[model samples]
Target: MQTLVQTFMERRGDLLTALWQHLGISMASLVIAMMLAIPLAIWAARRPKWAEGLLQLTSVLQTIPSLALLGLLIPLVGIGTVPAVIALVIYALLPIFQNTYLGISEIDASIEEAADAFGMSRMRKLFKVELPIAMPQIISGIRTALVLIIGTATLAALIGAGGLGTFIMLGIDRNNTPLLLIGAISSALLAILLSALVRWFQTAKPKRALTVFGVILVLLAGGGAYSAYANRVETVTIAGKLGSEPEILINMYKDLIEANDSHVKVTLKPNFGKTTFLFSALQHDQIDIYPEFTGSVLETLVKGTNPKGMTAKQTYALAKQRLAKQEQMTLLKPMKYNNTYALAVTKQFKQQHHLKTIGDLTRIEGVLKPGMTLEFIDRNDGMKGLKKAYHLNTTAKSMEPALRYQAINDGRVNLVDAYSTDSELRQYNLALLTDNQHFFPTYQGAPLMKADFAKRHPQIVRALNRLAGQISETDMQEMNYDVNVKKQSAATVAHRYLVQHGLLKGAK
Candidate 1:
């Protein structure tokens, strides 16, 4: 109860902000979808010859996976809300188009003849008779499209399109349950409301309501103008990686800098994922700062680590030393979390087998059901290294990386790869095997910055440094528990930690 109250107090602002964002994205998609679909449907209905081809084309788009569609758009349009909107609009077309086509085509030819006999013009007859009859079905199609787009819009977060999806994805990554709940529930509610609104439009006399809607639109246009005028400030563009943590870091930095130094405007241009890409962006001056893993920088970026053995602290120091020579790059202070990997087993299996360390598994290697990702097996410090270091070659099961735990509980696999700080470790009664051999390289979380840029923004360095030496195994476990199991928003939980630790002055 105490935790929930504290979380509510901390996350209320983010929750509200996310709500507003969701509304904006949902409505914008609906409006654009209606505009495009209605015209296309009208054209197709008037010329029945084109209906099959148009439907087939739209259905082909639907066949393409959602993620693939989003990825395909990324290079053409780059990242942010535009690509997301475009994808959602494309996805929304089928429902509205099909409904509109069917609604118009199904109208009785007798009615059309009757209207013609009354000496009405073709346009008048089409509008007064066909359109009115089709309105309900058209509205129903819009409802279906709106619901589909609303759900699909969650994927927008990956490209830095700010919506409830940002919360949900980050929450899942960090194991924050509250955030997932908030995002899921909010998305569901938006869909329900849109569905209800469509029904209401069908039942009620809509001429007056539509007039009011138009008025509201005009009012919003004016309000948007006012907001632009009021919030107008210099823009400080910072480009960097887009990931669960880095996105939040950029957002916080933007808020802090703008609040304290309003004269210096702040804008975020995110190109998320993969350390190599982030470093390249930094070198080209495309990004100002990004959160990076210290050990990853060492092993993957700066200086490759010893494949045999190296402590987390040692790996970090090695990375720091190597990066210090680079004129353009400067590694910032580390974050409170490590985001490292671990090996886990079900507690019952652990107790039954008396397994506590890698050595214990060597004896029963032939019988144990070991599970690991395909990628994990190839990486230098992954399963191969584990087996090489421990001399334990277990014949096992291969499954999807994310579903390893599910495999374990379903009695498919007895041993699986697990992250050191994963939330599910405790929730599922899993026991982490001691990595006494130090097979896995360190993956400490850190802030990497541009050398000259850091000098200009001392406060950014200060705020980040405050996070140093704060995150530990226990802290990470608890945070993961809150997110994955307790159902909290990552932004909320992250903000609370920053404030409680006095890393920042106010809750965001």
Candidate 2:
């Protein structure tokens, strides 16, 4: 308990920011749902057949997985708060709509007759008699929907939408129980408090309740507008892929840019999504820049033909040239590390099997079960390349980068693909097998952006390139270890590295 309290205190600011984001997003989504559902529900109550179809539609929406829905929204609307709210509103609509419809349609016919006998008009009866009588059920539905929204709002962070889910996902990625518990427990508490508030609205005077809701809407709008205006100097959205390394790198980009240029504001979208998602976002101008890899550029993004025997420098040069000519993208100077993919096994497993090379996995063919990431499993320089070059193949279960470590640690799998600079390798005491056949290409991390954006923002490019050949293999591994194992903030880790390395002057 004391340790948890200490952790909470240390991360109080971050926790509060995430909680506020979560609450605002959830509340905004619920309000939007209420607006859409109330009218639709009234129409449905009038036409029973249409109401049934509307119910079926919302039920189908409920059946769609939240992550899948977000994925679908990305291509249409891109990411961030927009898609997050849309998904949540869709989920919230069903409950609120159903409840509203049931409350109105199922009202006692005796009341309707009484209202008609009193000469109460249709609209008057709806606002006065029927609504007052059905208020309980409507409020109950709102409470249910609010709880659902609060719980699910955590996933919003996965798409660069800030929320408590940021802590949860970061925790899972770094294997930190403190972060996971903080996010989960906070979310549960938020749901309870908000549900209580909704219940209170059931008893409050209509004018008072409406006033409070109006105030909330105003606050949300005012806050968003103010934030936008404050950050209007020169907004540059910088995104990165999953993992502590990318998060750290993006923070470095943010810190260095802000330190170098006062007018430039760098907005970091850390853990934005997959490599392809960020690349697409860059192409579409949804984001300004991101940290990409030379190998991924060569194999995954460009879809270039097979290239072998290329050194790290050669890879960087080719990636820069091809990105400029083929894709009209800019690949900035890479860092000193080669964070290429490698296969790893536990020290015990390596010793037991005498595995020194990737080919050694063939010795345990049927016995070897490898845990890898989906991108790695499918990429040409990953599983495909391994099989083509090493003549080794196994039934590999694709999992997140973090879970692979957990699987190997728990003995569920004997093998896992890993980045060269992954701190988990140090934490887990795993042995990286030699890629004697040189299957994986050099993965030099660099700042990637549209060539036009690069040309326009030469200062931004220069600020980012301050890191060129600066961070070495050991430095990156330790930084990852700090954030992933030592439980440090990416911003702090990044800022400290920059200051110490003379890449950044004053902390922003």
TM per model?
A: 0.71, 0.93
Error of model 2, residue 112, in angstroms = 2.6
Which candidate number maximizes lDDT? Answer: 2
Model 2 gets an lDDT of 0.89
Task: Please provide, for model 2 over 1-508, each residue's C-alpha lDDT reduced to its tens digit, 9 standing for 90 to 100.
Answer: 7768888999899898888789889988998999999889987898999999999999999999999998898888877788999999999999999999999999999999999999999899999988888788888889999999999999988787889998888778888888789999999999998898888788898799999878877987888898879876769999988789999999999887887788787788887778877877787687899999999898878846756989999999988888888889999999989998999999999999898998788878988888999878898788976887878766689998899999999999989999989999999999999998887889999999999998999988998988999888899999999998887888999999998888877664
Candidate 2's error at 231, in angstroms? 1.4
Off by over 4 Å in 2: 284-286, 303-309, 325-327, 388-393, 499-508
lDDT of each: 0.71, 0.89
Q: Please give, for residues 57-164, the per-residue lDDT of candidate 1 as tens digits.
A: 888887788778876876666666677788888888899999999999899989878998999997797788988999989998999998998899887766656678
Error of 1 at 292 (Å): 2.0
In angstroms, give how far residue 298 of model 2 lies from its true place.
3.2
